[model samples]
Target: MMLRPFSKSGSFYKGNLHGHSSNSDGKFSVSEVIDAYKKRGYDFTCISDHLWIDNRFCAETVTDASKYNTHNFIAINSAELHTRGKKYDKENLWHLVANGLSKDFKPSNDEENIQDLIKRAKGDGAFISIAHPEWYSLTFDEAIMLKDCHSVEIYNHASTVKCNRGSGIYIADFLLNENVKTLLTSTDDSHSLEEDAYGGWVFVKTKELNEKKILKSLIKGDYYSSTGVVIYEVKLEKRLLKLKFSSSNNIMVSGAGHTNISSHGYNLTNAELDLENFDSPFFRITISNQFGKYAWTNPYWFNELDLD
Candidate 1:
């Protein structure tokens, strides 16, 4: 089935996958978050509350999935699996976003204990992502070892809340170490209602929007992370990664996904890199500013044979 074509006229859908509501610590209710994005011309959103996998709230809010699940606007359900944190009392939350899994899905913040939960969620065909690696001990070294992790968050809304120290800097650095295929996502880990924390989000390029198709695009890594900026398109070919910006502003793109990849400064509105390209497995991208603050895109895996 052909999904609704992405905004071909350069319009992009904005979504926050790691949002919280009164259900957790967020100030707004689910309805409030939806209304907020709708006002900003968002196509859809995922209410990935903390520690809960049940989307019954989503179903209840929309009432009719068919009507709301259209080309323009839709609501999806997801959860943020918690993990051990640096402090003994505070839990290190590792998010595992799932789609049609059983509502019984549970998240733990017990350091490595969340591994078992992630394995089970992936086994049941859920879309799982490692939350902010810059938070606790959830480093890229650990994420690389975890199997079936379809994606990782390059930037988190709450990252700034953690003194901007939780932005997945080290994770992006390690992406250059080995070729690991995984999608990258950005979420507004919102806990307050007064602020627009949904600053970081993904710009997906699918023609249609639905639970199935949206999740599929995410798993395939056909999305880009953004913070007040949008990547119109990204294509990696013949040891080159080409990126087009939606707006022509002085932008910076830097990150080490694979080894031996070096980048030249921006040539007008585009950035070019001769990074060691991977034909198969995952490759990563980082876009940022001179200030060292930026967003990370999930590794877009290239099939060995498809790299022609």
Candidate 2:
């Protein structure tokens, strides 16, 4: 089966799942952040400011449905939850992005256990995402043990801006190799417009642009993460995995045991991989342009199929 985002009927909506405002340590206010994204042609945005004592879901106060929702834009209620972890050194922390949360939802500040927080967030109907594993230098053993997370950030714009260590593809690859099913996301995690905003986003395929539909699509993995390149379609039939994309200089298929199939050229629009003889447990695709912009597809698990 194809691990694709688009279906036959729905349109694609561009959105950033992680972002911050003055409600936290971010420089921009909630209104200003919303305005910036709307002007950038984004269809929706989740103002996921930090959930802490001082911040306290401050973005909620500004997320007025009538003021932000229009024929062209939407605002989603979200937050970044940080919990104390003992697996790593004193400085290391566990950060999770909780999407589609209630405005009045309260997180336990006294909760120091990361796993417990994840469970609570899942119970609250929030889409949980492990955020910036690379930034925390999270090990595979540390990350793979966590449960109830829908996705992980393949790229975090804010982490990249601060330390140039925001990509988490290694952690993702490790989990996929272990047959743990999960999706990937690219988020701005933007705290400032100049350095972080609009750097990463996900293209969600949904029937409409409303908050509920968009969040549903996100949790269902009906999305592809991108830094700049655009993927038009991804399809799988029998043993062939095909992709239709915008201009890209390189298209690659990555899988277990260092399996890699790649095509490099100019003005490339489509690519295909024949997986009939492949034995990898899972496989995913990435497209990159000459300028280093990238788009990634969610991994397709082979063990789940009756490919006999």
The numbered model that scores best in lDDT is: 2
lDDT of each: 0.57, 0.81
Cα deviation in Å at residue 67, candidate 2? 4.7
lDDT of 2 at 241: 74
Best by TM-score: 2
Cα misplacement distance, residue 278 of candidate 2 (Å): 2.0
lDDT of 1 by residue, 112-138 (tens): 555677777777666777677765556
lDDT of 2 by residue, 1-308 (tens): 43457543689999999988787777887788889999999999988877744344344332332356788898888888766663563534567898887777675465547788888778778888888888878888787766468998999988888899889898888887777788899999998889888889999998888888887888878888999999987777778878889999999989986988888889899988787777687888899998889999888777655554
Where model 1 places Cα greater than 4 Å from the true spot, the runs are 1-12, 52-71, 83-89, 92-95, 99-113, 139-147, 175-178, 235-237, 247-267, 272-283, 289-296, 300-308
Candidate 2: give its CA RMSD in angstroms.
2.6
Report the C-alpha displacement of residue 239, candidate 1, in angstroms.
4.0
